[model samples]
Target chain A: MVAPVFDSGSFRDPDGHVFFYENEIYRTLTTDAVHRMERLLKLSFVKKSIIEGRIIDTKILEATKIFPKDFLVTEYVLWHEKIPYVTYPFEWTFSMLKDAAYLMLDLLSGLLENNFILKDGTAWNICFYNGKPCFYDILSIDTYVEGQPWEGFSQFLQEFLYPLMIQSYQGIDFQPLWRSTLAGIPAKLCYKSLSRSSLFKKGVFKYVYLQEKLSSNKTISEATLKHEFTHNAFSKKALTNLIKNLRLCLETLTVKSDQSVWKNYDSKNSYEEQDVKEKEKFVVEGLKALNPLSVMDLGCNTGRYSLIAADIAPVISCDLDPTCVDQIYLKKNSKILPVVLNLMTPTSSMGWHLNERKDIFTRVKSDSFMALALMHHLCISHNVPLSHFILLLRSIASKGIVEWVDKSDPMVQFLLRNRKDIFKEYTWENFQHLIREHFHIEKTLPLNNGVRQIMLLSEKKN
Target chain B: MNVLMYCLPLMATSTPCCAYLDAGSSSMLLQLLFGGVAGGLVFLKIYFRRLVSFFKAKK
Candidate 1:
């Protein structure tokens, strides 16, 4: 029997911590939180959310069936459905973040109708499962007070609204902002990016400008404000109105993207339709043979290959450009989770002790992977060595499908158009030699009149 | 339900545990003022006051 390992990432919650035992996810709820958990089990909306896969399915573990009985024996134990791949807000694209924000708002609104409300408004509470945002923090729900305004309102603004707002108004991607400040962006920080004229924007005056002025007041203390808030006759209608208004504002917000080079690589690549079909056939056959539980599509442009791999198993489709990831997310394809990832600078271990949020490497370890039409970009464009690129693939997955665009290819020539080709080892002979160092070459498929070669490989035994 | 429908006076109740997160005094106050048209009017007055002060301070 495997020992139960506590998830350091879930330590922030006072109610309980999540743990894994024998590959099963479990949550130990403190008695203080049990009432809410009990209520959630009976709620129609919560049941519907679980059925629709919006919320992770959970079940109360009986006292007799509890594993690691000595640990948290006093606390009420609950079993939770495990997410195949865990991702942070910083790894998400604009549409992914927007969808997560909406999921929280809509869930909170529905919970409020059932006399319960989500106490925490952090994006950390939601994770994408198969390209759709799903809330997993069951402990966040608490009894909705009759006249109390949403206590999570300010948190929602900082964590979701402000980050999203800056992206919409200034066209600045929120990934860098989220990476820098995990606690969500302050309204003042968001205010700085936006033009002075942007204050007149729909939610600007109310959510941003007004909130900034009010929060800047050092005269009133948060405790005193809470005291005053409790004294004031705030109504449920007012709270609902606020959520409704926020929904309207957030729904309209969108990031206007630039003409990214890699965003439309799949559609605009020089590869012919027949070559593409042959490549797809190779990837599918490779995936079928590997029979891996999960597949990671590195440089998954528009998730074309990810869609084909998704037919075989769950895929973690990744691309540097938010637009490409957003397109994959828009497809809402089952078994495919699209993440915005820059291969050169993948997300790092961060937060307190750097364990609170698992880095990209730790989170994205898969059984197999596909790096289709991506070699030229990584080695040729980004200056990453072909050996280093293959090493990265070998570290994350046991087997994968890698495509090599020859130096004579049009795209390769385009990448080398302005820069001098100092790369002596970017040849087929070196690729085979280097890749064999880490991975055993299983089969190779040629595409686009032999200009591109796709190889399926498995990790060589240690 | 429209605002014309009798706006019932609700007695504020305290739920200390509900606010483990520091919701910020001014932010909650602003949210209260952003309830509806009446709330918007109240915030508008505050906004204009701040705008006037901002210009005067700049000068």
Candidate 2:
């Protein structure tokens, strides 16, 4: 069964609800969504954008049966590839956000050329896949009539432009803004909160003041309507100029936060030079043995081991700390997807009525996984049984490089210094015995440091 | 190069004309040229700052 993970901020539709299923995700379209989907598919721009890279492929699944309650409609889309881990707009670096904004505008411009328009321009609709951002929501595309005003103009400014501007021009942190509002930071909120300096900057002035003024005072019914009429009266040159000004502002916007933790992880780890070398050699050998196409490193603090594996294959380095993910992501530039994950309570697949976001197990089936200096934390800190730990590891990865820290190790001693070691089952012998029941021990490497031992295990014979 | 590429959409948001030019706004080619130069300078400053520091340390 697909377990539920994140459920907040999901859009409500009459449809059956979107759920993450196995390797592929499905969004059960209700009658209303199905109707909209049908109309959307008819647009030529949709066809062209799909043919190009502007839109992600939306393939209708072949499932004839329906889930219980028949809450879904006649059709549902089986999304083959969802982002490995979902990252909200707030977590993005300024450059990344700017790139996403540009991608949306570029796609919109292409849709306009194809005589179509996007129904919305929220950054959430864009997900980073591979090294580039790709549009995922097919529900957001619709036919554009020439004479109609741009309906999503305000949303475009609020979701994409205003947030970027706030970070870029006013130097205000956008993270709080995103955390507070799910619909995106409101335009009026931005118009009022941003500093006056933001409006006077060389190129930022027109965008900060003019764009906000256009979307403000909806209830007042002031001369803003005439201003909008006059603004719309501009020739294609002027309209295009407006689009260009916003584009320039986005391109120059940069977030300069020196708050990354990974930048100084090497200096902070306190590993003796020789000990560090030994650990690196051990990790590299483990990675080579696994030969993974995709690997997940648990407790990948600052990604020391994850980057070693990333040299071989794409790695999803995850840690309990957000600061670690932020630093690793900035260093790698999205090559390795860094996510804030707690192994104790990993993100489950929860969305629209509890199915949109895929759970940790369903989202990944990595060929190789590494849990270096990690089991002690699970056993002693979290009180997970040795048997449960083996089963969980096997479930996540077919093969793994696991480290078993004996209770006598000083690190474990430090953990037990003040408290009782109720974990009699946390001995090396018990861990090895339990692991053998579920895995074939291929090789074991003992390090000079008495704290950790690495074992490579495969599922061939258990 | 990365910053200019990043900012193109922001520049394009209010001034749609800039959307077409990879450099900047399409309406004012001169301003686009100027923005391009400024952006390239920013990249250069970042790229060489460390290098300059390195040489100073050596000296």
Chain A TM value for model 1: 0.94
User: Which 10 consecutive residues of model 1 chain A have the lowest summed lDDT?
Assistant: A219-228
- Pick the lDDT winner: 1
Please give, for residues A307-366, the per-residue lDDT of candidate 2 as tens digits: 787778888777765555556666744457666666887655544546654565665557
Summarize candidate 1's per-residue lDDT along A1-462 as a digit string, tens digits: 334588988887788888887788888788877777887889899999999989999987664566554554435677899988888888888788888888988998899899998887888899988668889988888898776677778888988898888888887777877789887788778888889988889888778865665565433222343443354556677788878888999888887766356666777889888887788788888989889998989888888888888889988889888878888888889788888899888888888898888788888778888888789988998888888988888888878888888999998999899999988889988998999998889999888877889999987997
User: How is the predicted docking of candidate 1 categorized under the CAPRI scheme?
Assistant: incorrect
Say which candidate scores most in DockQ: 1
Our tally of clashes for model 2 stands at: 53
TM-score of 1: 0.88
User: Which stretches of model 1 miss by more than 4 angstroms?
Assistant: A1-4, A220-223, A257-259, B1-23, B36-59
